[model samples]
Target: MDALMAAFVAAALAQVGDRPAWLAAILADRYRAPGLVIAMAALALLGAGLLAAAAGAVLAPRLTPEAKQLFLALALLFHGGGALFPVKAPERLDRWRIGAAATSLAGLFILAFGDGVQFVVLALAARADLPWLAAAGATLGSLAVIVPAAVLGERGWTALPLVPMRRIIGALFVVAALWLGLDALRLI
Candidate 1:
């Protein structure tokens, strides 16, 4: 479906080299259980993505076309700017009391609460009439980034030039935002 593909691509690209992916890597290493880490991460992503889609479904009907476009553009603009700056993720989480699955679930769910990928999913869903499909796509897209990190482990993560990748994606998002923003204003 159009909504599914759009959401999938947007969320997948938005999450590349992002905090959640890196955090998954950390968790996989710490737990020595990549499968468990991946499962927990998947569950978290699914929950977040569904919630975003639901919110978008509720909100989209209320917003005018221009408003929806503007909101999506703004969300993209904000996320792009943040990605370009590259904030350092929290160095540690207290995992002493939690088991591997619990730690991964809790950490990832909490970390992804308002993350760019989730926002991207929200924005995509907001634009799509089929919001549930968008949510499913977003969840899979998130796994596209997360599953690899869990399977490949630390060396694989280090091999990627994360900062450069983030900047590139950020630049792309900004360009998209500008175009969408302009169109929303009827200037394009």
Candidate 2:
């Protein structure tokens, strides 16, 4: 479905060089448990996606299609603008008494909460009235990026041209937002 693919591609693009990916790389390097880090990261992303999708679904029936489009446009604009800013460094969780796996899960989940990707997932789900599909797509898309970060560790991850990738993706989101906004306003 359009919603699913849109969520997937958008989340994947938005995730590059983001804090969550950095956290994944840091955890993989620190714990020397890339598998555990990847698994925890997937779980965290899935949880966040489901929560966002659910919120979007709850609003689906309340709005007209044009209103949903407007809302989604706004969300995309926010995501695009935020992507232009450099992400803050991921925090080290050295003091947690929990094992590496639990720490990873908690840290990743905390970092993902209310992030730009989640906002896009929420908007897409509402627009398409396909919350579960959007959530699944977002989870899978996020994993596609996070897995490499976990496998690569910090040094390898740092070598990526994440800044340029992020800028391009941000520009794409802005273009999509503008188009959608125009359509929603019946000016296109």
lDDT, candidates in the order shown: 0.83, 0.89
> For residues 105-143, could you state the per-residue lDDT of candidate 1 as single tens digits?
988888777687777778778889788888889778888
Q: Report clash pairs, candidate 1.
A: none
Best by TM-score: 2
Q: Model 2 off-target regions past 4 Å?
A: none
RMSD of 2: 1.0
Cα lDDT tens digits for candidate 2, 1-188: 88889888888888888888989999999999999999998899989999999999998999899999998998899999888887788897878879998999999999888578898888889987568888888888888889999899989998999988888888888999999999999999
Could you list the CA RMSD of all candidates, in the order they appear? 1.5, 1.0
TM-scores for all candidates: the values are: 0.93, 0.96
After best superposition, candidate 1 residue 138: deviation in angstroms?
A: 1.5
With a 3 Å backbone cut-off (N, CA, C), the pairs that clash in candidate 2 are none
Q: What is the lDDT of candidate 2?
A: 0.89
Which candidate should be chosen as best, given lDDT against the real structure?
A: 2
